[model samples]
Target chain A: MFSVMPDSAVRIRDLRKTFGSVEAVAGVDLDIGDGEFFSMLGPSGSGKTTVLRMIAGFERPTSGTIELGGRDVTSLAPFDRDVNTVFQDYALFPHLDVLRNVEYGLKVRGVPRAERRERARAALRSVRLDGLDGRRPAELSGGQRQRVALARALVNEPKVLLLDEPLGALDLKLREEMQVELKSIQRRAGITFVFVTHDQEEALTLSDRVAVLDRGRIEQVGTPAEVYERPATAFVAGFVGTSNRIGAVRVRPEKIHVGIEPDAGSGGESGGPAEDGPGRDGRAEGGAGTGDRHAFGTVAEVVYAGPATRFVIDLESGDRVVALQQNLRTSSMDVTRHRGARVRIGWHAEHEFSVPETGAGTAPAS
Target chain B: MTAVAGRPAPGLRRRAAALLHRRPLLRLSLLLSAPLAWLVVAYLGALGAIFLTAFWTTDTFTGEIVREFTAVNFQTLWDEPVYRTIALRSLGVAVAVTAIDMAIGLPMAFYMAKVARPRHRPMLVSAILAPLWAAYLVKAYAWRVMLAEGGPVDQALEPFGLSGPGYGLTATVLVLSYLWLPYMILPVYAGLERLPGALLDASGDLGARPLRTFRTVVLPLVYPSLVAGSIFTFSLSLGDYITVKIVGGRSQLIGNVVYDNVGAANNLPFAAAVATVPVVVMLGYLAAARRTGALREL
Candidate 1:
């Protein structure tokens, strides 16, 4: 659930965008609080970028109202709006140097030469690019170009900043580094950031609240922990992380414990309600205790990942589940021996949540 | 390698490919030899001959090319105010034609490359090139008819209480502009096409209105192509004589003087000397353009 702010930074009501007969963004409503880093996370064609563009005034919605800082900007052009976008390609002016590129917005607004230059320099310094202002964008590395793009938008001091996968082009290490820098920049500037990315890890790492989208609709909007732990819909449960369907509930892979022996005490055919489970604090810990549910299965496969080992189990109840265990005490040979071994999977019932199955032709109970 | 040689050696084609692969410069020269020879003999050789002729003199009484090295033709060109006027007028016409073509070509190119739908772009390019398929002389004569005393141009301006330019220098510039518009549009369209659409979007997102974005972002990036287009329009207009003869009325340009001297006056040396003026002017233009890094783009 999203908290109600008195004056939200951006509020959209019944937004829809259609290209010909295909609807890119179906009717939706959202409220982004001021200074909050909110992300729209989805797959490539899931309309997350469309929603961000609509918020930035780059794309007009077919029938909806968009309010920015309590002002209606539905029909306004991008230049008239008080929000800037960090384009996916960085889009720095190739002909202009970094300083001039950053000063462009101020110059176009009639800011005097001396003042704009000083501000542009300060903006560049904020991004840790002080002496590189005279260098062309082509001369800088990809990460530097990304910083310049950020400074160019931040120098305008808009109410909100929209980034359309700005770090999508960077390598893995640089992307992680820039993610930290971006979070710091947002904090220093105190501007509401509407980040759109198909990278689920990036969205979870940087955003205060994440909106998981599927097709043209938001599957769930919540904190990263809430979305990952208690997904509202089956699509969210599947997209955010790996989940296994057990009867009427979906459980995460890490919640299920793979053991060689079934415990005598609370390992009956039917289990009781759990008092403390992974759902309480979003962590999978502790040994099986009373009220822990049990399932009989055999290890179908064992995957020895660097940090953890995954066990695929085929249950006697005709359900399949994957259980992950940290390799703190087990070596590669120890975990690899579990392949085809008879095992028992157990987890607390509170770790499971009911998700409405999408496109199953049955009405959702919730 | 010895075993392969004993097994009847590799085929000639394979052996040649192996040799060429071993020596890249040899392969490159082999590839370029034909075109290089043609370019040297047919193009640069003709230019060298013309430059050499420019220093020779024509025998005035016999009307023969004496082939004697002399500055008399150059001296005559300098002393006669008429030759200077013709050269200046030619330069003026070239500048006007280039300017007009650019003013019209840039917007047309932008619309084709950016505004038009992707499916419609090829059709728009074909339409822009449609005029180039027509004969150059036909188009020039067509403009001549339109600029006639009471023709279509004059009739169209009748309601505005204005008359046509009436087949003079303005008419020549107009005809040449029409003839060479495709050259301007093609290169500019290519440059604008290579420009990413996100750059324009980024400019507008940075609080620049469309006009400001065009001035600061679009114009600067597309400047090289504009220069490339002007090279075609400028040089083509400078060396054109037939269009002027068809629609120039009484105006005389450098091309017309060169043509008259070589034809009626039978003064080959004088014509070659006059021809060098445009060549020299073009050389200066190209050097200036190269300094701006426009030729690198071409």
Candidate 2:
């Protein structure tokens, strides 16, 4: 479908970076398709920003060949590479007005003045920052500066635009609004955007494909739903959202069904909190749930968030597991009203996925 | 509580604090009075007396202060080619020193702040500032010894078949740039240190090469500090007559004119007029530097 254009906008092969004895990005291989809105989601030290910087040619990888549109640009300087970055702080020049800042890249590349101005203005207009060409970055609000940073990069029409937590500095409401606006801008521009963010929800909301990095290695790469619904590793399950560890098995807290309370010793299968009747929830199933699984726990605490009530459960013989129940009705009989109540948490066999107790066994997908 | 035996007197301290709290103006005056007194009395007062004397003249032969209000000194200043030459030569030395110091200090400061490892940065700064510890005259004499016809400078340049420019405007500029380099380096270092690393990366990511980034991003941001540092170099170089005396073999800067007229020639009025040149030059420089946001940095 991408005629003449390389299938992958950016191809990272065995990319690795190390600082002294510490490896920041460990042998990551990813092929981000052209026009794809991809996100690298990880914690602060997970090497997500480092990877983005390497792709932008800001950080040199210790060993890797990065290909942009089928041409290797691993050794090229940032200016030689056809990509730009929207820095977290926006990094707009304080001395220059918005127009000069936005036109800086084109000006450096020797684009004609009229053409540079016209393109910079159009880019600013696209970001909804029209009529702000004369204000210095210090004069603009945080949101306006952010849009100017975006406009500055977008004006370059680079092969890939790298963003390192571009919305991280905004307030919650502004962040959400900018998230939608950024995604829409990505769609309109049709240029590949490789965004780095620690916010999983933001990643899920904005990315077409998401890659989870942990301890400088990619744990999983898939569609947002795939990574969120079916986490490939224990870290993914824990980091992406909330997950309940029912013994060795990991299941989504939202997928588990909670019963009012369980009897101390009911040994049957007919929904009597039993152990044998379709209660193949036997401990022999390890973590990957077999058929259906049932566990008994006491609801030690109930947290009432607006839409959902999270019940922190103390399983009979394992670590605490949490179950989420949506408050469909506005009645006051919340699960909180039944704190210290014994509850039965069960999930379908398919809802349960096995993960390594530790992160030693996974292999990169290449 | 019982009456304290070992405690220091609190009544006086408490009463003073209470008085200050009741009248903040008293606290403000207490904080400002000493510096203000020194500045007005020791600095501006002397400047006012000197400028006033520039309007008076002395007897030509009697060697007595006539103290007559006259424009003779200023007229002589306006009509003399010697004064013009000295003024222009001094101005040239100041400008050259500032330019050379900036040329050397910028890259050195950039290296110290950005390129050097953090562990080594303090050592670099100390080395840059270490020369200031030696007395100025001692260092200038040392340079005098080094710049002699067959001295260390000649020895160093002998292998290259080149010789140092000894004891002239060039020598004065070289010594002044050497002395004022740390002044320029420290401020520019501080300015570069305050620059966000992300800005450099952002500029490069925006398709600016290293030189381009330095020009557009680094230069503009650090320009104020450059101006601030130049103030020290320019003003100090302009007013210096000692280095010119030791290493300036035959050179006559404005400072030399002031010293000769005031002391050797016994023409205080003419000396005051000559000294006024540097003061006016500096005021003009400061006014110009203000537009570049240099005052805020200073």
Candidate 3:
């Protein structure tokens, strides 16, 4: 499966890095398509930044090779590699004006003075730092410094751009704005961008694909929608969003029959997978029926959020099912009306995704 | 309280409290005034006395200071080739010593400030400062023994058949350099240490080579320290009398000339005038150093 043809803008093969006794990045393989906004998401010590650093050539991998544009850059130094990094701290030269900072790479590449200035100005303008070219980094605000950092890297026109939590220091509103700005820039440049961030929402919002990392290893990799809707593991489910779990093999939303209530449902031995029945007592169990979900629960909590109403239902089989109902003009999932009321939770049997337990200990598979 | 409403107290206790509060300003002024007066009396007054003495003439008959003002002492300094040679030689030596000290001190300071591991750094800095903690007179006397004809340095050089003037100049530069090295290193090291580490990394990422980075980024950032250290080294070497006497091998510095005029020649007025030159030079260097960031640490 790993020996496929090189349709990727960047191919990472068996990449490994170690600092002292601590293995920062263990063996990993990945392929990022051209013009794709891919993000590596992880916690602080999860090796996301290490992988980004290796790609940027700030850190050399102890083993393996990095191929960009189908060219090997394993032993290449940072400047020699046709990739630029936007550091988290920005690392803008305090002594130089914004224009000079952006022009640094071009000058080193021996670009003509006038051409370099023109390119730098264009990059600055793209990042909305056109008129602030003469200002020093210390003179700029946090958001402005971030733009300058982005401009500095973009001015180089590298094959791949690596951003290490470039907007981590910004306020929430500013971060969202920059997320759109960065995505637009990536689209305009049509270049591969490997961004590193720990913010799950940011990764989901900006990334075409995201690789979740844990303990110097890739936990899972998928498109944002695929990972969010069909999380392969409990970690992905909990990390991407919130979830609730009860117990036993029960039924999913679409399979379970939703009746008003007959003596608060059956109170004895719970429902099991019948010979030709839809499912069983636990939502994530049973191979009884294809495209069939079943579960009965009391609507314990209903939260009417802005766009969707979230319902937390306690199943009769000692399980909880979380359901999100999109709020249309006349939707029935109102929390003030449904709270404490008994309701069966089910959806299209096809929409039910069962992720097998893998001893991950991830918030009861939610 | 009802009977005495709106009336202020004038009892003994209240009067005492009011007097005590009022006298704090007066007490503080009195306390600070003594040191201010002492500085004016001891430092400014002494300088003024020296300036006055510089214009007095020494009587040839009895070696007594003649009360009358005269330019005869200045004439002697101008007319004598020995005095002119000694003055030039002092400048030459001070400049050479300062240059060599700076060259070694700046890099050493850089290593201490930026490169040394935290666990080992304090010991190294203390070692540099250890020399200053010792008695300066004792260290100068120690060099006297070391630089003598049959001393350790000469004995060590006997095998190479090199021992006379080489010994004197080499010993002087070495001893002077060693004594003043800390003065130069600490300020420069502090400046380098206070520099932002992100700047170095940014410069490196921007494709500046190590040498280019040091020249453009590191050097300019530590200008204050360099200026401060150079002034300190030059001024300290200029005013030193014992170190030059020990290692100079009878070669005269301005300090030596002033000493000779006061002690051997009994020409106090001439010595006072010669001493005034260094004070002027030191004041000028200090002013310039302060304008830069050099004097900030001190």
Candidate 4:
């Protein structure tokens, strides 16, 4: 009922904010589609939180216009804006019970008593907190309190919901569970969600689309797979997950193939051209070409993770790359040995992408 | 096997520390007993003795306290119109002072805690507490002079054809409010300071205007501390006799009656009986505050 326009739930035009001398959020433009689960992903101090706060009206941009559903709300107060935020701390009122905390927004909007109760109850139920509505926030556990905060924000039925690291405080298991729960709730509610997180895995698992923020600027904005598989900058490549950098190109550890070199002592034998010989059946599954880009290196370290084993290799070409191999039906890591054994590693040429090379104490340009 | 050949089995200090570490309740009881004993004996015991004396009789002829248990003093206090008036006057003054201090302190404290610059916050706190540094008697006397006829206050209001509220109930109320303003502000400021910025931001984002936020979120969150602060103002005003004596021209409160009974009349039992009124009022006020969950903050 509060929305004035039909599409583009949130539209930010060249938004900027500076805290004295520090440019917290430099000029950035964004368009969030209606009913989209959009995430702003970054490392700490990457201006993702600042952008979310600006959209929620907690921060006034230095210069720009913000519109929700086509109505400009840049100058409007937070209360006047059709947006609600689930805070990082899950800021539930300690004095009020869960029901009252959930009903707070409606009560402030002068909602009728019985209707407010029903809406709050339904919101609580949506968060799986139906029977716990009478509990004070202090009495509830961390995850329960987080659900109360979510319920409190959701009962208002704002046009857009901003979540500022809402799952940052939970433990690993609880965080993973809440991630699935939050996404399901978003789907069921069909409200545009702008979730901010410094954790890349959380963003990738939850967002329909994600904007990669780097040092107060937008590095790239696309679907999670788009940002992950084809990062636009060296910083993004380094931040999202572990990427093996070979000069200007980056390839994931999982994409590289690792196996023993057939002839370890042969001086003229190179792994690439010497392939497609007898007893080379294992090399056919990977590497786009029959004799694709390959390197011969000695195993530096072997790390046996439960589902996968990672082998770090030091190439004779003076570059290093890590290759992760899944543990097939067998239980032992005997296939990849630790240290001093010469091995062959190869990856599809298309898996490699260009990224700038940056040295210590410097950030690569986007 | 790793022990040195010449080393003693264990030093007394190490052994004692190990024992203490193993028995936490014993350690805690040992640590708590001293302060707990002092609190019960020195503070609560004195209060118990005073309340006990409130039921005793005072011999009028010899100016001696008779140990016989009697309700004569309370009977006199209830029957007499003067005592009733004095108690009511004292209660009214205390309530007024508390109200005035809250009116001035809440906004000032809020500004200091939530809005002031980091560098300026300490200076604002210092300014609020600076007046408390002056001696209580000295401040009261200063107010006496300021409210005197042709004094600074009267002179300032001379051109407006108005005069100061010359030393009376009004003067007492004003001076007490001024004296205790920091007491009220400090607690409320500390409460507001500890309030996470995220809560206020969440309130605003939930479609609450600033005033509505204050009325609903900020006010309720800060209420316990506000009540904690009112405890200081109300009790101080209720039991104050020195400030009244310094600035009060003709006004007489419960404290004044107690003081007169104890000093001029040399009636200790009667004074003890009179003092019980303020104690009872304070207890009732505390009970009311506790029901609002303010005692938890305290």
Predicted complex 4: CAPRI docking category? medium
Please give the distance, in angstroms, between residue B70's alpha carbon in candidate 2 and its true position after superposition.
1.9
Segments in model 4 whose C-alpha atoms lie over 4 Å from true places: A1-7, A260-291, A358-366, B1-5, B9-37, B118-120, B155-161
Model 1: CAPRI class: medium
Off by over 4 Å in 1: A260-291, A358-366, B1-7
Q: Select the stronger candidate by TM-score from 2 and 4.
A: 2
lDDT of 4 by residue, A43-96 (tens): 899899999888888889998889998899998889998889999989998778
**Relative to the true structure, how large is the alpha-carbon lDDT of every model?**
0.86, 0.86, 0.76, 0.85
RMSD of every prediction:
5.2, 5.2, 8.4, 4.9
Q: Can you rank all candidates by TM-score, best first?
A: 1, 2, 4, 3
Compared with the true structure, model 1 gives a TM-score of: 0.92
lDDT of 3 by residue, B198-227 (tens): 666566666666777788788878887888
Candidate 2 residue lDDT tens string, B104-130: 999999999999998999999999999
| Candidate 4, RMSD to the unseen true structure | 4.9
Interface RMSD of each: 0.7, 0.8, 2.2, 0.8
**Residue A349 lDDT in model 3?**
42
Candidate 2 ranges beyond 4 A from true positions: A1-6, A260-292, A331-335, A359-366, B1-10
Q: Which model scores highest in TM-score?
A: 1
